[model samples]
Target: MRFCELTEQEFRDFSSTHELHSFFQTPEMAKSKQEDGCNCYYVGVKKDNKILCATLLIEYKGRLFKTFSSPRGYLIDFRNKELLNFFTNGLKKFISKKGGTILNIEPKILYKERDMNGDIVDGGFDNSDIYNNLIDLGYKHNGFYLELDLKKQVRWAYILDLKNKTEEQVFNEFKPNTRNIIRKAIKYGIYVRELSLDELDIFKQLVDSSGELKNFKSSPLKYYQKMYRTFKPLDQIKFMVAELDLNEYSLCLNKELEEYNQKISKLGSKSDSKKKEYQTQIDVLTQRLEDLSVKRKGGDKVILAGGMFILYGKEIAYIFSGTSTKFRNFQAQYLVQWEMIKHGIYNGYNTYDFYGISGDFSKDNKRHGLYEFKKSFGGNVIEYIGDFDLIISPLKYFLKKLISRFGGK
Candidate 1:
């Protein structure tokens, strides 16, 4: 087999049809990274005029030596040891000649099957051979990480398999609480709609608010703007926002209040017990009306949550999301996710990926709440094989690590 550089179209044609294709491996993603100061290369192995293995490697120039990364890539059959070895050997040589110190890869292959509760499945498919093969081929195995820190790609994700399933079937699979929350969100007049590019600030504000509340930093508005510009033309990305129609909610509440008033009027001469029950109903409705009045006084519509999704090949990935703390009880975030899931099902996508969750499942873990929330949607927790580094220049790689550790002090 001969390794060669492929044109953008040529690489896209092959990768899009491959079962292991990810949005991160696309030419558009490469172009976006290029704008961010990385040099992108699309390389493939061909034999008998057919592409075998392919990857989109990005070269990041550092002060000491350059580093290469293949994000969730190397679209290949890991089970085929000979083919993988050939690709790695050629890739290492290619990067070494280009003055790269290390080549990092975080393949999309699963380490082991994990259930929704984050427990390993007994007798499930294991890719220990693939893991061993990389180590044997001279790549260093980064330790399995349960935290979401210090990793290129997230080590864990939640995926809802929508294959051959109807929307109702998928909805029914959700936990009872999740379904109730979605229902409540809808009942509260929360609706989701696609945001045009001009309206991206709404999403940015939501993310910024969430970041501040959670004490995490969010990317600048221009970053999302860049992504939208990059992927929107291909219909490969969407930004959706969940909003509450306060006017409509208020109208509904007023109508309910009118019905309660009529019931009380009709019970003018009823028994004292019946009168008390009607009074109690009226009181509850009146409180709800007052709350609705207060909320609607601000504006006719208020954004409660928003999310950005990436669509590529067969999967729709929920890449980023945030919710308004003020409407937490209404559960607008749940509604946003349900909308995306329904979109995937109606559009015939194979999977809805609730991307990125800390692998640490213990309740004490800071991100455990996120894990539970995603798990409530009834999907498998995927633990990937994690990151591996192919050292091309040992001295350069060592020096870089040494400087990084000591800050060159």
Candidate 2:
């Protein structure tokens, strides 16, 4: 079979038809990455003009870098052992002709098995074994997906099973405090509504504000708009806003409750019987009302759960979520997750990634907050064995490595 590059339109058409295709390897993702600083290309293997396999290729210092939608990586689905030699040999010859260094690939076919909740429970395979096969083909094996499991590699990614679970049942499974926040948000008449392109400005404002607070970078408005344009038509993505008014009655109730609690706390120190009675009544009603409010608001309060969706066909939805800091005490974030899970289950997708997680899980790690939040959702942590590198030219590779090592302080 001959290999050829596929056009953006052809690639998107193919990808949209296959659920197994990862979002990263799609033409749309490649376009985004290109904007972020990478030269991307799309290639497909064809036999008798019928497409057999396709890959999105990125270039860095002459070597090829490939990734599928799951995340940036080397290859998406490099499991066609029969074509391994053909692809590797073709890649080497191509690199040599172009005076390049190497061709590096990390395929998406899991070396391990992952459960529905995105946890790697089984070590399906390991790098050493795969390396041996590559070695036989004169291809160097590089370590990738650092965390390996018999069935699943990393545990952080997950899919919410929505078949039998109702929205209420799913909400009930949340932590007590989280549920209470959703209830309070609802009691205040806070609502979560789908956003439109006209509302793009507000979404961008939220994204920009959030980026500053989190110290992370974001794509331009054009990119987000392009995303909506490309993915929304297919129902593979959506945008939404959760709002609350300051003058709402629940706002006043919240203030009153806070004051009442403060007074009870100060009086309780004296063990006054009258204060105790008032505290008891306040506690019961406050807790009950708060719970009711949370149930009504659903998952809109949670900032992180703002973006949620299931991959429809091969096109996956990128759910962008956020929350106001003013409502933190009520835990709107939890409801955000609950709603997304429900949405995913209803749509039925291959996997639902929580996006980036801390590379290191220690409390001090930058990703600690995200890691903690994703874990509570009850999904498995998946370590994609990490990234691996292969050098085509020993001298150039060594020189580049040396330069990188001592380039700066």
Candidate 3:
């Protein structure tokens, strides 16, 4: 029932085996954040020489006060009320001693049971007790949010369970349209490959284009490069891109066009109805050929879509993704995701997380398109408990909020 600082190895050993472990709690991630100018601390609660709870606290120094955040952390069994209370009280005191004015946590526990469409499941497993415990322990609950705003971590995500399942089993779970789109990408000769470090520029460009199209700002190239360098060596990260092999696709289209032409020629001697049918087929094939030719004339290969994924514990998280507007119909994004899912299955991961989505499932919500796309993959929508702030210095916390509200300098 006491809390103390833990060495990196001690923290990693506990976190790696914890059910709620995430890559954000890893030493490498902490090191990367440290390099980005945040101070990282690993603390654990223990008794009888066994750890019960742990977290990676990131110290952010503001101009006036310091704040701490445990990104998707506070690795503890939330159901244990006593343990939760002890950790909260101990953590507040510890952070206060270090001059921290605020402690923010976004635990990776589910808030409630949610169906695939982001609707709550009635009479399902509820974590209200756990939520109440945190609030009762003096932690201020941040309101449940649906939009992708300034929260340290996303509130909603889509996760596909891959444990004890075959590739066909998982593929069968996808919606019919989703399956068709993946097949279409393959038929169109969309090639997916793992990108090397030197090729991250391709991913950066894809992400930048996506941000521009979505009207959101993207991280600079250096951020992704650092992440790759930090986690790639441990075989914990994968950067994948889908490309259209224009020449090969063009050849396939040309071959199909020739076969259709041959059929049309043979149908000339048959009934007019048969001839008309073959002519219609020819027209479609001919137009597709023309389109392929135009595309091939530009380049042999064109990047269509790319995504970055992180493999930690039992989950492979699809952290970031982007697609090319020019080849939107080609459905390269579907192929990219299929490749990652297959990779996860091959690697024996238990889950494939389509990481973040807007909690607002209403059609009018601007980001609802994201939720729909992830839903098509047949994953359940998950809502986390969201962020909680444990104020260490009420004066500083109040002043900061006041300043933020009035846009103070």
Give candidate 3's whole-model lDDT.
0.88
* lDDT on C-alpha atoms for all candidate structures: 0.88, 0.55, 0.88
- TM-score against native, each model: 0.93, 0.69, 0.94
Cα RMSD of predicted structure 3 = 2.0
lDDT of predicted model 2 = 0.55
The number of residue pairs in model 1 that clash at the backbone is 0
Instruction: Assess the local accuracy of residue 393 in candidate 1 as a C-alpha lDDT between 0 and 100.
Output: 91
* All candidates in order of TM-score, best leading: 3, 1, 2
Model 2 lDDT at residue 136: 75
lDDT of 2 by residue, 250-339 (tens): 555677678778888778568688687777868865874675476456543322224434355522333454544434444555655555
Number of the candidate with higher TM-score, 2 or 3: 3
* CA error at residue 96 for candidate 2, angstroms: 4.6
Off by over 4 Å in 2: 17-19, 33-39, 60-79, 95-104, 111-169, 211-214, 217-223, 249-323, 362-366, 390-396, 405-409
Expressed as tens digits, the lDDT of each residue in 1-409 for candidate 1 is 9988988988999989988899999999998998899999999899987889999999988776799999998899988889998999889889988999999999988999999888999998898999998898898989898888633698999999998899899989999999999987787688999999899999999888888888988888888988999999999999999998887777776787788778878888877787788779878878877776677767889999999999999899998888777766666889999999999999999999998999888899999888888988898999999999999998987788888998751
